[model samples]
Target: MPAGEVQTDSIVRDALNCGKQVFIPYIYGASKKGTTNTNIKSMMEMVKLNSLADYESLQRDRWGIPAIDPNTFDQREHVLQTSLEKGEGLDIIFVPGVAFQIDPNSKLVKRLGHGKGYYDSFLHRYQTKFHSTGQQTSQLKVPPLYGLSLKEQYLSTDDEMEVPLETHDYLLQGLAIGDGTFHNSTS
Candidate 1:
């Protein structure tokens, strides 16, 4: 954990100190095949990690996010399968976003991700009622999904601006800003 950042540093530090098992997303370019698919598609995988040494062992990906090196800790298939079948997976997910469009009236928030669609893809399957098909995503029953954003990333809610939505994007249930305030969706 470093100083003068989004304070998730403290969250990690405290979680570790409290003897919590901290797992970071270990992304791999998984090649998928469909019945009539032409291209090999890539997806992200969640990998469970424990211990300080585990954190130190990771290397940054192309996007500069520190991810677990698959050579040391690879638990892709296990994590995904277990998570889909069991509810005892990650207690909370902190997502990073490029911009946020919040509508308190509708109790919804749309996140525009940083292009790779890693979080977007991951959250669609992970979050409780939210799916990739853009159905009912705001029931908030799953482990809390919080979006981490800088204050500048938050768009004005007063204007009712249209945040463009693609079918692959997922909705967030809560938001945590760099300023240290956390906002939960109101139902």
Candidate 2:
């Protein structure tokens, strides 16, 4: 995690304390070579973390962010696995970005990640897998994605800077800044 990125400790704690199911990104197969598709080479899975103790027990990855170790954690439930079994996916996902811009009129949030397309690729995979099962769209739960940003990461509507968006990039439903401010896209 960078210095200006939104911290997840409080959010994780609150979600756990409220008895909400928590899942963290577990990236794998990143080192594979000879794959043209980046998504195929590097895959990410949202694995369930049972309790606050589980959250606390996480080991820090290269970025110093707490992450679940696949080698050690044997009984992991993937988000897709849960969705397939229970017909319910995540309700919300707090995305981290390097920069964010909100449209003044539409209120749509555009995000710029740190140049790694992990989240975008993960989302694309999720949609493809869920729809491929021939399940009803209503039955398949697609969560509203929100961006978590620090004050420095957000660009005001008045600012001239733009967050360049790619075709595969996702628009956030809302944004939560570090100062506890909420910017709802629908509003």
Candidate 3:
């Protein structure tokens, strides 16, 4: 297996083994590709976990409560909405990226994703709701947003990257390298 996948698998095993519920972003619509939760579960079973679910199910199914088919949701918006209805909050949000940068001052980080703003949009919308209700949003808490990548896919600082960020977009909490290295944000 590739080094990046090795690192991701290790971190995932650690997270799940430690009983830390993880929320992995799943792509919706026609642009989707790559391994689904089934594949993740197959891998997880290697380490003795039962199953894996999308963010929607993970949020709603606290204490191993099983959720319905996650495919019924329209998008990340639906996931967030349903989660709120279930009286649950997001704990960890695992995002995939090609590259990311850590801000020096706020210790904030941004991931350069597939050039689409799905993750960015979802976060912005949810944060707006949190702000309107005066509720503490997880986006502000610097939850671990690990980026999965292959070794050859790594980009250096000189790459002149354009990480999507709205005016109210929340930065990532930390970065997990493909080598199993977790880099925390330091302001």
The number of the candidate with the highest TM-score is 2
Q: Give one digit per residue, the lDDT tens place, for model 3 in 36-114.
A: 5352221110011233433223443342332333454344334345554444455566665666666656666666665
* Total colliding residue pairs, candidate 2: 0
**Model 1 TM-score?**
0.73
By descending TM-score, how would the candidates be arranged? 2, 1, 3
Pairs in clash, predicted candidate 3: none
TM-score per candidate, in order? Answer: 0.73, 0.87, 0.53
For model 2, the run of ten residues with the poorest summed lDDT: 30-39
Cα lDDT, all candidates: 0.63, 0.81, 0.49
Best by the lDDT measure: 2
Alpha-carbon runs more than 4 Å astray in model 2: 30-40, 134-140
Q: Assess candidate 3 and give its TM-score to the true structure.
A: 0.53
Candidate structures ordered by lDDT, highest first: 2, 1, 3
Give the lDDT of residue 50 in candidate 1: 70
lDDT by residue (25-95, candidate 2, tens digit) is: 88777553234666466767788888999999998877789998777544788876665456666778888
Model 3: residues with Cα > 4 Å off, grouped in runs:
1-22, 26-71, 74-79, 104-107, 137-144, 151-170
Give the distance in Å from residue 62's predicted Cα in candidate 3 to where it truly belongs: 30
